[model samples]
Target: MTSTEQAVETFDSLDPTTDEVVGTYPVHGPDAVAAAVGRARGAAEWWASLGFAGRAERLRRWKGVIVRRMAELCDVVSAETGKPKGDAQLEVVLAVEHIEWAARNARKVLGPKRRPSGLLLANQAATVEYQPLGVVGVIGPWNYPVFTPLGSVAYALAAGNAVVFKPSEYTPGVGAWLVRAFEEVVPERPVLQLVTGFGATGAALVRSDVDKIAFTGSAATGKKIMAAAAERLTPVVIEAGGKDPLLVDADADLDAAVDAAVWGAFSNAGQTCVGVERVYVHTAVYDEFVAKLTERARQVRPGEHYGPMTMRSQLDVVRRHIADALARGGRALVGGADAVGERYVRPTVLVDVPEDSAAVREETFGPTITVTRVSDMDEAVEKANDSTYGLGSTVFSRRRGMELARRLRTGMTAINAPLSFAGVAALPFGGVGESGFGRIHGPEGLREFARPKAITRQRYRMPLVMTTFARTPKTDELVRRLVTVLHGRR
Candidate 1:
């Protein structure tokens, strides 16, 4: 059979709300993935040679194209993910900002910088810089398809690497749209390429001859990717699941806290990895907080406010969590066990849930939250930190917001707000523990896809001659004396 005939397998991307096929794409297998990577190798060399200024200029042009065609891309995102145009645009906007940031800041973050040569090597000049890692394989997730994946993709591109992206099968059209837009600005080579398929395609990308891998999904999937990449000794960045929490203190603005909780929990059908999944309110205002949260949650309709669960199978997980919570003596203030529908899940606010319950311990990835009342800020912090996943958290305290936020065992935190850290272009973003490892924003992200290169120059010959065999007994005694003088006191 010809190559086209051999690659005849295809799949349909469906609208989450309607279950209608939005688009059909080929199921790219190992051969296709390897071919894409091989093409990227040449692209990587050419892209890196462009240097920071040349790449930034092209990236800026790409941003303009994205902005000009924002509505069209948003439509595609909405079609596949079933999110409202507004929600889709929000992620797109964040993605554009990230692209801009990565392009503008790559030089400052990865450029060579002079390093201080210690007294022992006073005649030597030293500097360090980060260089591109050739080709990068990005396996994106369906939820927040634009914002989450671009967190790594844009940074990798700015660091002068060619990208072979394998977006989630659920949103292949969105992925294709982004690649096309990039090509319009960068017609010289295939700097960004898209391969659409299921999990097998992603596995192939991981095993291919890529320099590094950046994956965003469940912890189980992240572990599998890590194991596969280990065979090639390829470095990876995993942005896995999160069971984030929000704390409401006695002095916090009740109205603001309620609004944040509602938006964070119900927005995007609560599929956000950093969305507020749990809330801990001080006993002083627990009753009032619950009343307001329930009232606000009731006003959030799935289709109008957010959309249906993008992946149909996610509905089962949401259903199971709510059922287990209810069965374990938990009560739903708004939508209960019946909240989960065929396509959409009604906004559900659960209370009196056991701390060890699945709904609290695991990432629900749905528009549901558990509100637990605590006696004081201490209990609030303790309970909030009682999870294996430590990704993001929010603290709503007028007087001690910063203090509490600092104490939380999370990678990122917001004071008196919700999901604020994600919107900023300068702050580093990632999580520890089960939530995943490595960062994807700020200077750290630019360096994640690049290898650090250190350079040293001999300004003059040192009297001691420490690094050569020409050193004599006098030189050894001098080195020992210098070390003793420099470090012995401490």
Candidate 2:
């Protein structure tokens, strides 16, 4: 059979709200993934040769294209992901900002700079710079597809790496739209490409010869991707799932805290990786907070502040969690077992939930939150910290916001707001433990897709050299004396 005939398999992208066929894309298999990576390898050389300035110009042009056609992109995002157009617009705007920031600041962040040679190597000149990692394979998530993937894509391109993106099956059209816009700005080379399909296709990308992989998805899928990449010893940045928590302090503004909790738990149907899945309130404010939270949560029906669960299978998970919560003596203060619909999940709030319940321990990627009361701030912090996933958290306290935020074991924290850390282009985003590792966004993100290269130049030949065998005895004695003088005292 001809290669074209063999590669004719395709999949339809559907709208979660109506189950309508939004678009279709090829089910690119291993052979296609490999070919894409090979093309990216050659493209990486040409892209890198463009240097920081050339890439930045192209990226800036790409940003202009995105801004000029923002409405069209938001439409695609909204249609494919079932998110509100406003929410989609907000994500795209953040993505444009990230692209601009990466292009504007790549040189300052990754360019070569002189470094002190230290006391031992006073006669040597030293420098360090970050070089591109050739080709990067980005496996994006359906939730916040544009904003989440651009967190890596823009920075990777700005740092001089070619990207082979494999967006989620649910949002391939959005990915195709982004690549189409980027190609208009950079038509010279295949700097950015797309391969669309399901988990097998993503597995193919992970096992391919890409220099690095940036993945954003569930922790189970993240582990599988990491293991697949390990076969080639390829580096990976895994942005996995999170059962994030929010702490309500005794001094927090009750109205503000209630608003944050409602928005944080119900936005995007609570499918956010950094979404508030659990809440720990000080006993002093537990009753008041729960009452207000329940009222606000009831106002948050599906199709208003949030949309349907993009992945249909997620509906079952949501049902299971709520059922488990109710069966285990948990009281549903808002929408409960009946809240989960065929596509949309009504906002549900559970209180007095056991800490070990699936609703609390696992990521309930739905419009639901578990609120547990604690005796004091210490107990609140302890309960919030007792989780395997440490992705993002929130603390609502006028005075102790930062203090409580610091105490939570999370990558990013929003003090008085809901998921505000993601909008800031300068703060790093990632998680620890089960939430995964490697940062995206800010300076750390720009460096994530690049490898540091260090250079040392000897200004002049020195008689007291320790790296060569020309004169070892005197050099060894001098090195020992210097080490003792410098570090021994400390």
Provide the lowest-lDDT 10-residue window in model 2: 463-472
Give the runs in model 1 whose Cα sits over 4 Å from its true position.
Answer: 1-7
lDDT of 1 by residue, 1-490 (tens): 8766643799999988888899999999999999999999989999999999999999999899989999999999999999999999999999899999999999999999999999988898999999999999999999888898889989999999999999999999989998999999899898899999999999999999999999999999999999999999999998899999999999999999999999989999999999999999999999999999988898888889999888888999999999999999999999999999999999999999999999999999999999999999999999999999999999999999889999899999998878989999889999989999989989899999999999999999888887778789998998999899989996
List candidate 2 segments past 4 Å from native: 1-7, 472-490
Q: Candidate 1 at residue 247, lDDT?
A: 97
lDDT of each: 0.94, 0.93
Could you list the CA RMSD of all candidates, in the order they appear?
Answer: 1.3, 1.7
What is the Cα-based TM-score of model 2? Answer: 0.97
